[model samples]
Target: MKKNNSPFGIGGNKSTVSRREFLSKSFKATMATGIAMSGFPTILPASVFGKNAPSNRINIAAIGAGRISRGHDMPGVWQYDYAQLMAVCDLDSLRAEDGKKLINDYYTKRDGKPFDGVKAYTDYRELLQSKDIDAVLISTPDHTHAIIGVAAARAGKHIYMQKPASLTIKEGRIISDVVQKSGVKFQIGSQQRSSEQFRYAAELVRNGRIGELKTVYVGLPGDPSGGKKEEMPIPKNLNYDMWLAGTPEVYYTEERVHPQVGYGRPGWLRCEQFGAGMITGWGAHHIDSAHWGMGMERSGPVEVWCDKVDFATGGLWDVHGIFTTAAVYANGVKMIVSNEFQNGIKFEGTGGWIFVSRGDYQATSSDPTKPGPQAKKLDASNPKILQSVIGIKEFHFEISKEHHGNWLEAIRDNKSPIAPVEEAHRACSACLVHHIAMKLKRKLYWDPKKEEFKNDDEANKMLSRPQRNGYQVK
Candidate 1:
């Protein structure tokens, strides 16, 4: 790992090594161990004679079975043989039932047996307390991720939480600290890190194929502005009071409560209570890819500048809807993250610039000598590059499947996740810095070691928000 020299380095101690230095060392260690192990012959130990290893299936309790959980995490978890869905929990009874029925139907169709013993609950804490559950999947709103994740960790269960991992910078840090202390496996929902496409991109940057990345441009959709709206009666199945856990209470509104399926109205992204706007929403995934590629997952930018622009009335939300912001790292790397640009990421290195998005990967310079085949040939041994060279197909569902499988493997092997809590926290912290810059409308210097702004009390205060009386994130 790179040595962190910031005043607020890991474990609250200053270090001589830079963040890049620390990551480089860690990468070397990982490569040495992994490559060496790959060469070992596959032989059974004499201790077990010829018996096959026992199947260590992880029993998972899913907290907050909302739309994302149902559409993404649920299927991923059910499809993996290393894990089984033991229970489902959500504030909305209908959503919980929907998730339960889906899992049961899947198991019945796959194994030709009635899948019973799957419990459902409205309270996540109760679900976490179940002895049958060995791990938990948290797909709650942004505000409740830390609460449920921390509780699960304290209960001696591994966690799979959605991004952004925490609603605030301090909460993100606290989650990292708690997970470290607990010694439990914690995986953030930034599955892109485990995706072959993203991993190859990051490896290219790390292996110098991209030649000392100098700038990273990430295009996000936009921030939440809590646009003007009318209050509506709380839905019958949803416990509105429970849904407001860990957030400031606001009157229930149809737009904010239910996700829009088709055409009529917009979804909850317009509200500030449930999410961090698009910055924390989609930005969490794309910005995380940028950070991973830039080799800056352990630290963030030292300064941020906001370029505010008024939103046009009656338009769909975009990343720059709230405001546009640019962040500059201490290492001279510049990141322009706003909803204004087309959705994607660009890396400008000394040798050339490469652009990657959900759909395409190409270089700005097409010359063969500038950045063509030579760039692709930079790292022949790197697994990421080898995978790409061997023609690993790329698709969103495939990436999600691979990421979920990695998490399950990590649990069985007692290893860290592909996107561990600490790295995810740092990525989310970078996103939070953008939010702070937009709120202040100024370029602000940051002291990462202290986890605060350099001489700005007002900016520092934005690091965390006041928790509701019973929902503190401890």
Candidate 2:
């Protein structure tokens, strides 16, 4: 693939590169690097590099280099030698340039050669078409994940996308299908699955340490009331059209587009057209953990009741003023996912209960009223309750390392990621059901296997939305 300097280099704006140029340049560069690295007593023939060369380091590009990209994704990818940051894309030129500087500085500080040829793009499509990029990290707003992810898959790039994978049910399905068809590896940004404490907690629940699970309570911040706000001019540096891709075209407002102030209250959350409120944002994480722990990654609730009054309200609220929602699984198990409560996952079983959050994990089974076994001391070496309880210290350590390392290994081996596209779609589907039920102000029955509403036509209408002309998912 001949790499086109245009659409990516100095004078490039937003434009697509020819596929033929992309593939030929990438192949030539890869073969040259392989031959140079494989020097021996006698030079191997060029044919040896074909279909037999070991996979080289993957070149990664990041789309939507926002706050989370800087805080988590960039550092995570940098930690692995098998991946290299090649390009960064953002609607705001300033943020995109800042990310490029950050990556270059990291390499320079490490006593390695600085990234002299790293590219920057104001448009993600241009980055997607670059044959140099093997994968993309999507840390954009919740609504844009599906469109960019699908496009990246079609362009033959693997993806590491942030959570609440899609803003709508249909979008999630479309992303899953695209990845499957393209044979691209995908890892959703639900990092808790890669955490030691979380894995132990999930293992304990899956093994019935807490007895048969009766119910799970996953709490997140509440929903939005779509409150009124004043409109402001779009910043000069921002390309508002690209930012609103796949979303309805509405008048630009500072609160909706950029963070003139702090990130306190983003305007996009209050609008039904561009955001999924808290249900798809924060709920995606907490509820995803609940489903993971319950061993329901492939399935979700069969019905959702939206009249539940568990949500935050009033002018005091930061993003959306007020909202509430609840979901019921087919086996009579209920999951309450709302911003109304503090962020965490609580499981109540017949034997006892366990609670876990980002901060800590606690299990209460010792009865003070009656004589019982003495409480064991905390194991500092393992520090995971499930391992400590079962005396399986070795398993604990291995699981901890494997979870985080799994994504990198998957990328190198071209295998499905730990939390792959299908699983993410299922988690997002559960939240989408709750969002739809709440919007229609009614209880809705769902057919999980079919991925549709059982009988409600009005509720099913919210499954997918009409896309703006050029931005529609194919």
Best by TM-score: 2
Per-residue lDDT, model 2, residue 63, is 91
- C-alpha TM-scores of all predictions: 0.78, 0.78
lDDT tens digits, residue span 1-474, model 1: 242233221231233442223544675567568767898654535432211112245788888776667767878778876578879998888878877887788888888988776788989988877877888889877878888888888998888888898889999988999998987778888777655566556656666665678888787654444444677778788888877887888887666666523222235554555666778777888888888777678888899988874442453332236457898887788998876666667777887666656553321121012122222212232344334431223111112236677677666555456678888898888888888887788999987667889999999999998989889987
Our tally of clashes for model 1 stands at 17
In model 1, what lDDT does residue 204 have? 61
Please, what are the lDDT tens digits per residue for candidate 2 over residues 1-474?
011223211121224443333454587778678767887344556543443232356678889766668767788788776567879999888888878988888878774765555688999988887877888889887778899999999999988898888878888988999998987778887776666566566656666666778888776645444343565678877898878887888777665654744323455655556666667666676677788767677788887877554333342223432456677787677777655555567777776666776553211121011124322211221234344463433222123243325565565544445677888888888878887777677778899889999888888888988888888876
- Residue pairs clashing, model 2: 1-22, 1-23, 1-24, 1-25, 2-21, 2-25, 220-338, 220-339, 221-339, 222-339
Query: What local lDDT does model 1 show for residue 188?
Result: 89
**Which run of 10 residues does model 2 get worst, by summed lDDT?**
362-371
Report every candidate's CA lDDT: 0.70, 0.69
